[model samples]
Target: MKYLFAILHKLRPLFPQSLVNYGYHFPKAYLAARLYGNPGADLEIIGVTGTDGKTTTSTLIYHILKTARKKVALISTVDAKIGRKNLSTGLHVTSPNPFTLQALLRRMRSQKIRYVVLEVTSHGLDQFRIYPLHPVIAVLTNITHEHLDYHRTMGAYMTAKLRLFKSAKHAVVNKDLPLFGEINARLPKVMFSTYSLHESSQLKPDNIKYFQDHTTFTLGNTFYSIPLTGEYNLYNVLAAISTALLLHVHQSDIKRALMSFKGVKGRLESIENKRGLHTYVDFAHTPGALRAVLTNLRSLKKPAEQLIVIFGAALWVVSLVVYGKRLLSNLIVLKLST
Candidate 1:
């Protein structure tokens, strides 16, 4: 399948972009999944897609389902798991090509896996990479400025995300984001639930507290805590918990699973050292993600402590440029105050 795509890519210059997309890419992917025995139809699949937190949210959902004694699998940017077997993706892409994805799902189905949690990306949705598999539950963490380089506009980017909801039986959305209204308006045909920091949301958090090593918050009268610090993480937890509730997992089990989750790597991962200086490594690439991570780190530091940040630029150069200037200006202010 990949060989065919490679050959087509070489001839891509001779064809229109739409022709390559609809004529070649979509058909090739769909047929590959069909050849794989249509594995997606054998299990309940949960797809989590958004600008940020897809990996973390998917991982958390997988963990919770596993803790509930369900035979489950996880496919995320960090790794893919089927029971005891773990495979590193070895690539930066969140969603793999259709051939790779379908093959993995076939393996899981053969092992009698009951549920599969997948991290869906806008690119995958737009390209029809996750073809032919309708999700049982779809989750949207939140939409922000991202992937404009490919989609060309926020409306197009959002439309790509909305594709997931269309095929899903149920959806869990972040009510705190302004996009919630738009998403809700389009979900009349799909059963959906919402979570938020606001009091009116179906799943809302209260009595939030952040510590250097962990965060604690209350969902209803039940207290939950995780060893991941930051308000953004709190939102990720909300999404996971909401999904679990919709799946009929008990509250006690949800709390237990959350307490045991160490967290996903490269997402605000902390490093220890002999010196007292604190450091963290995070995969926050978008402007919204960068701001969230930086704000969380800043809140963790003492007034006299220096907060240093290093970033890598790859895709989304426009967002990086805008964030870079703003970050530098803020750093200068911090320096002047010190």
Candidate 2:
């Protein structure tokens, strides 16, 4: 493929249109089909889709699988990896088209990966960019007010995300959430199991400490810990741990993986210390997401430390592009006039 692209690059001057056509199309579809279609590449695809927690949950799944010693590939909003190679052709957490997705899967096939975790988006589904692929297991993390402009309503948004269950062999749902009923209803043919990160029975966290920039939670027993903060992340890890258990992974291995799973980039990513304020750059755009993040930050912060969110009206940057839905792209960029 590199040779093919190189040869095409050499021949671009002679047959620009021919080479352009192939690059623009055919590859993601052709490569996905060639590598995974028909017989479908023998790789397991686990699609994680929801308004939030998809990235964290997807990463958690990948890390747990890696600890279990299975070769894995993942496509999240932040990055794409085939085994260990990062295949981020774009800076944003999305694939502009399906071809890119297919092409990446082709690379994964060559890596001899046994598992593939894809962060599926409603936008990707809406645009038909995720076709020609099947997820053996689908995880519905949660749903909130997001991507309304693209789907036009909460109902439409829910429908778009539910397609994960529609396309998977087994669907994993957060049973604590009310939205799961509708999603489960839509997946009449698909097998599903529920799991919760929320404290149930004897599996709750032993203790938790929250700071403005950092939060740590002790994993039920021993000295192991989940090295981030937020109730949402608790659910994310619970979802990942449940999937790991479903895959028949050992508890020891899952615990080991969870300890190492820090977080995804820009999802409340700390930008070092700016003066005295602990600045954080989060990939939150929607109303629900923003509210959750701010609330989490407040809960995690020390009593003495104050949090003054300086979004600078960057909300629309994520809404319109990240999820590919126009959730009223209204931003208020702050500038001190000279």
Candidate 3:
């Protein structure tokens, strides 16, 4: 299948982009689904997509549903799961090709998994890799500058992300994003709910507090706390919570799940050394994500402590370098390594 894709790439110059997408990739995805018995049709799928926080948000939604005793599975950039069994993604890509994705979904369907929380990507949406699954709930964490190398412009990138909502029955959105209005306009028929720090949102956090090891906030009159840090993480929590509520999960169950939830790996993950120094492992590649992680770390630092950061690149390395330099100049002791 991969070889076939490679051969198709050679014909890129002879065909238009839409033709290549519809003729080659779309059919490939559909064939993969047919071969896998159309597993996505047997399960309720939820797709989460954004420039940042897709993994964490998807994981959070998975955890919440699992804790509530729903048979749930998750597929994210970092890992994939079926019931209690977990596996590393093994692929560098956030969303794998059609054959791989449909096969995984088929396995989950065989296990009678009721729900799947998937981290959808723009590349996957544009390529029609997720064409077999129409999500019951689609979440947009937020859209920002990302993947411009392939999409070529911010508008195109956003259009790719918005594709998820087109087939979705309901949507959970970040009210704080400028794109929210446009997304709402586009999905006028889709049931929409929003979360934000602002008072006007349907679900807003109150009494927010961030500490070294955990953060606390209130949604309505119920207080909830999570072991994850960062104000941005609070948004992630809100996103998950809103989805749970939309699914009709009990508020008590939501609180219980969140309270017991540990943070996602590689997203603001903390490591401690014997000398009591702390190191963090994070998959924050975008400017907004990098800034959020650093800002959270700064708040957690003692007055005299020094914060050192290490970064690696993924989609937009050059843009990350430029943004990192500008954002971290006064925030951390800057160190660059090639």
Decide which is better by lDDT, 2 or 3: 3
| Number of clashes recorded per candidate | 0, 5, 0
Candidate 2's TM-score: 0.77
For model 2 the local lDDT of residue 83 reads: 61
Best by the TM-score measure: 1
lDDT for each residue of candidate 1 in 63-179, tens digit (9 for 90 to 100): 999999989999999989998988875588788888889999999999999889999999888878888889999999999877665676889889999899897988999889987
Worst 10-residue lDDT window for candidate 1 reads 329-338
Cand. 1 TM to true fold: 0.92
Which runs of model 1 end up more than 4 angstroms from their true locations?
1-4, 13-16, 314-338
TM-scores for every candidate against the unseen true structure: 0.92, 0.77, 0.90
Backbone clashes in model 1, listed as residue pairs: none
Cα lDDT over the full model 3 = 0.84
Which model, 1 or 2, shows the larger lDDT?
1
- Cα-based RMSD of the predictions, in order? 3.0, 7.2, 3.4
Error in Å for residue 288 of model 2: 1.2
Candidate 2 lDDT over 1-338, as tens digits, reads: 65775576576557544345356334544554565443334678888888788888999999999988988888887778776577774767564365566667767777777888888888776545576568888888889877675577788788778766776887878877777667767778998767654524223555655554344655555444677677777778777877787788888998788777767888878676758666778877665566667778776667777666655343345455444432332221111110
Report lDDT per candidate: 0.85, 0.70, 0.84
Ranking by lDDT: 1, 3, 2
